[model samples]
Target chain A: MALDIPSPAALQLTASPAAVSAALTTTQVRVTSSFRGARIVLYGAVFDPSTTPSDVVVIVRGPDLPVRIARKTKVAGVWVNSRPVVFRGAPGFYMTASTRPLADIAGFGTLRRLGAGIDHLAINAPLEQHTETRYGVRDVVVSRLGADYLDWRRAVVRLKENAGLYDADDKGVTFVDKDLFKAEIDLPTEAPTGRYQAEIILFQDGQPVSRKVRSLTVEKAGIERTLYLFAHRSPWLYGLVSMALALGAGWAASLAFRRN
Target chain B: MDLYLPIAEVSVNAPLLVALGALVGFISGLFGIGGGFLMTPVLVLMGIPPAVAVASMANHVAASSTSSVISYTRKRAVDFRMGGVLAAGGVAGAIVGVEVFRWLRLMGQADLVVALSYLVFLGVIGGLMLVESLQSILRRRSGQPPKPRKDRRPPWLYSLPLKMRFPRSRLYISVIPPVLLGVFVGVLSAVMGVGGGFVLVPAMVYILRMPAGVVVGTSLFQIIITTSLTGVLQAGRNQTVDIVLATLLLVGGVLGAQLGAKASSRFRAEELRALLALIVLLVGLRMGLGLFFTPDEPFILMTGMG
Candidate 1:
């Protein structure tokens, strides 16, 4: 589905300088049993069309979750997991779309400050303080593993990327007219269920002038929701019910076979 | 028909799951086993998370064994007195197993432990079964009867305290051995997600010296209790039980088991044992190869625990 901001709204916004607003085609994604994937369009308007052209950056981040990353090493000629590190508040889903390459749009410092790209994404651990001085991009995440911390951080991004949970597009945003702009993001089947924030930023002169945040939710629906809730909210009851269903099914099958 | 499983949090082909369940069920019914040993590995291969595969298959095994126990009871082949003692020990073992499973998961070693257990148990059991069955088959071909297994209880077994008489099996022995056997099988069922039939059957025959006729029946009866408890514990503790997945599997399993039981009458017992042993060995070999092979991805990610 294509999202379109009304032209009248853009015209009204044009009266006020440096104003931007965006909305997703659908704010709530219902993940039923048959759900495969979904494509959502983020459309918005730029207020000052007559002014110098500005770049648009869109970032969609899913709910933060605690994750553990484990690396395997060969031991006794067999591959086994050796060291595991846990990172808290890591986004389960993260995607970035921009009018131009993030590096070309702004300097590394500015991009890092804005958190505009995958490399600049913030991932933190709770223990062992350390500073990353790689290529003059100083970011600090606490870790006791010394230099291995960077490897773990990169591993998170690499693993998430392989799972289709992290993505970035250099030229994902496009302008349809002088003031109308849109970006399309594909939410894969592996997307986690939670609230996702879509941030739309208008960058002018290599600086973010105005930003708007739109949020969407991905949630289980129908039988999927019922079962998920049943399993989590009341696990003991769910277990009993599971046993009852299995026993009943077994008893019925036995009776049927016996009668024949 | 791809369907999303809520608990496993993955989409799997519905028909594929049913067919897998049917295949395991057929084998179980033919052999009078629980089939969990076969089912869990296949599910893991299908990309269902290992923990979910183990727990949900326990549920499936419980159902399948329940059906088999009924027929065994009707045949008057079950030793309820022994089964009860074994089940008591099994319950205790299952409780401990679940805790260990959770601990292993937290340490990110549960999958490795599961695979290694399968390889070791399947390799030893399958190899032994194959050798014994092949020898019997060879003996029958030469127009000779199979050698009678020594049914004498060990000297140490007689001196143990808390002895009890099992009238059905016609044995008076210490309850310690049976309880210990039950605990070992119970731990196996919880950790490896098996009905523990393959292991239990051999131990009963060789160690407990149970009659061959009652061995299968009593094993099924014990499995029904142990696995049901394991399923409940896994669901309550780990929240890994997928009802939808289990139901689909049960539907195909119940139907397949009935057909397999009917077909079992046509095959020679020795031939069946040889076939089952080969299948078990093959599964073990595959599991072992996984440990040796270099994985495409050496890094793993787990969520929910910090």
Candidate 2:
């Protein structure tokens, strides 16, 4: 059956594919869904729908955004949302959009963008770190930003890395029993104010079957901001203050009991 | 040492503390001894941080003692007048103990000294008590009338001046022994993480020849002084005194103590003494065994005034 699928409407060809991928490295991809082939997914910013691919199929991808991500609709039984999908590798590779849902099942997918599209990767099963069954997967692809888009950088998606976004020692996550396992990471004082994309990939026989792309955040709390106001430039002092507070509170409680 | 339990932070773990407190309180009530004799050592054995264990035990002691003491006082089982004199001495001893603790800490010998002293004291005193009670049983079995000493004080304790009368105990003798014993128990209080009642009660009965009526109250009075000081000192130094931990033990101890006191009334005095002896023997064996054949060094052997 023929369907009037959504595709990019005001499409244009300014720069060649090679030049577009080179110029728009990571954060310089425009969302234009032009359905010419068996269209699968569309990668674009949520702000401009006109740039989003339609006529075939569309799925908003890429995280590292400034605001909230909302749910759009479902293809089958799985929930699809207007969010960022990150593929950790170079940009400028052809991604074929599959017309049919992955596994024709409820909760799994392997999607990619067509021409002028961003790269995509998928995983198998979910993992919960608390349990003993742990899983991990890794895949990278080059994506292209349309010539007219502002900037699209070569988005790198490593299956595992530490995140300082949580103001911990590391970033990203590992799949443990279908749950997420994030190690500690350090957060720089001048880090950007946006959501970073990190996906938990599950592998079966070295190939991804199930996947979950998560948006991580980096922001200062009120108390953290107040402390930063004076010594906002020093991360070392900020860490010291946090340790001091934990220790001080413990000491004060003991003192109060001792007095009574 | 990773010795401290994170339960002090979690609200869900409160029940464990309470249950432990109640069980220990019941045993303490039954045996007529402060649970610290068992608890402090048990916590230490179970790998609790010494500072937290001792401070927490002290808080537990205060709660447990008050639990039983209140009921004993209401029932006219506690003799306040006699308790007052011992408390006077106890206060003085506690002050000296605190000073000694500071001096020992400065010398970097507090841990070893406290532990060693407890090991020696428990070994010697517990052994002596066991021997005496066993001998008494043997004499009874032999069907011989027990040879009794004349009803007169030993010359040294009797000869001292400042002989004062204790109305409740009805004794007129020197106050020196009780005071000295008070001092000794007080020093022990800090070192051992006990309320000092175990030492105070026995010393009163044997050394001072105090009437039974006065024993519990006097020991309780001494405990109040020593433990209160201990609480403050530990908090000031180690900052391990968790109010939440203390509060849980107190609630459980109070309720358990009340129930224990009622249960005590149902048993005869002779039966109670027999049961107390068995408990004393058991605790003494547990401590004594810790001293000799055990590979893991009894930590008590390395503490206070040693």
True contacts kept of each: 0.71, 0.00
Fill in the DockQ of model 2: 0.02
Which run of 10 residues does model 1 chain B get worst, by summed lDDT?
Answer: B297-306
Q: Tell me the DockQ of each model, to 2 decimals.
A: 0.61, 0.02
Error of 1 at B8 (Å): 1.3
Best candidate (score: DockQ) = 1
lDDT of 2: 0.46
The residue pairs found clashing in candidate 1 are A128-A143
The models' CA-based lDDT, in order, is 0.86, 0.46
Per-residue lDDT of candidate 2, residues B244-298 (tens digit): 4565666666556556655776875544555555555565556544323433211
* Local distance difference test, candidate 1: 0.86
Worst 10 residues of 2 chain A by lDDT: A16-25
